[model samples]
Target: MTGPVRHLHLTELRARVLSEDPAALEAWEALTNHLANVKRAREKGPRGFEKYYEACRQGLHRLSLLAGIKGISLYTSRHQFAADSKRAGHSHPQTAAEMGHASDRTAVTHYGRRVQGRPGTPLPLPSPEEVKTVRKKLGPSNGPHREQK
Candidate 1:
């Protein structure tokens, strides 16, 4: 990621997203190209970035609903990424750098936990029917709620 990030002024971070899946890289490249064109056009201005981000957020929400997850926002991915980095044995400073923090305090304080055994792996979503059955067992409310108290 290059350019001025929200944190730490106009400093460029050294972190790069890597994946063994070629399709993931291809998709990222395509998005990068599109974003470049949008920047060049300078038509949308500040709203252009927001428009694309909202589209991505909505896409993720739809995908989560399809997978039987009630809510999964873009911020949730940031938390997951931080935890995954820690689980993968990254140091506090490394995690902070990847997260674009000037210090490790924010990364260590907020995201990730001390875990044992091997690193965590992604799990496939439960079947839709299974989700339906679980929801049924939880009653019409679906599950617990803070407002219930």
Candidate 2:
């Protein structure tokens, strides 16, 4: 098979792929062998990328089931990973790049949650008096502008 190529600097993942470690090397070999079998299956049939993707999804589902983890899906795992990365003190741009987001905004808006306070805590609204005072300060300009007669 081919030598391991450097993709990212994930220390744990990298350690598991290097040939210097016998157990890790064996695990990597088994993974590569399985992938090769999948590639051979693709070459022998009309199955393409979609089939490979579905197979991966099925495998993940089976693993989750075996682990007794309920409500874990691909999307949920992605969201969790993004949140975990953020919590681990990674910057927005760094997390976005790692997650393959087009921009940092995507990572913040979709994956990241508000860091302050408890999640789902209702924000306090302005009191009636406060609302009236603000409205009074705004005056007649609150509505759409009208042409002066």
**TM-score of each model, in listed order:** 0.51, 0.47
For candidate 1, what is the lDDT? 0.50
Q: Which candidate leads in TM-score?
A: 1
Supply the TM-score for candidate 2: 0.47
Candidate 1's residue-wise lDDT over 12-114, tens digit each? Answer: 1112226345654565576578768657545677677767777778998999999999868987866776666566655555455556555555665676453
Model 2 Cα lDDT, one tens digit per residue, 42-149 = 786776645775777888889899999977676775676566555555545554455654345555557635342133221122233322322121123321222222
Q: Give me the displacement of residue 98 in model 2, in angstroms.
A: 0.3
Clashing pairs in 2: none
Q: For residue 50, give model 2's deviation from the true position in Å.
A: 2.1
Candidate 1 deviant stretches above 4 angstroms: 1-3, 6-43, 114-149
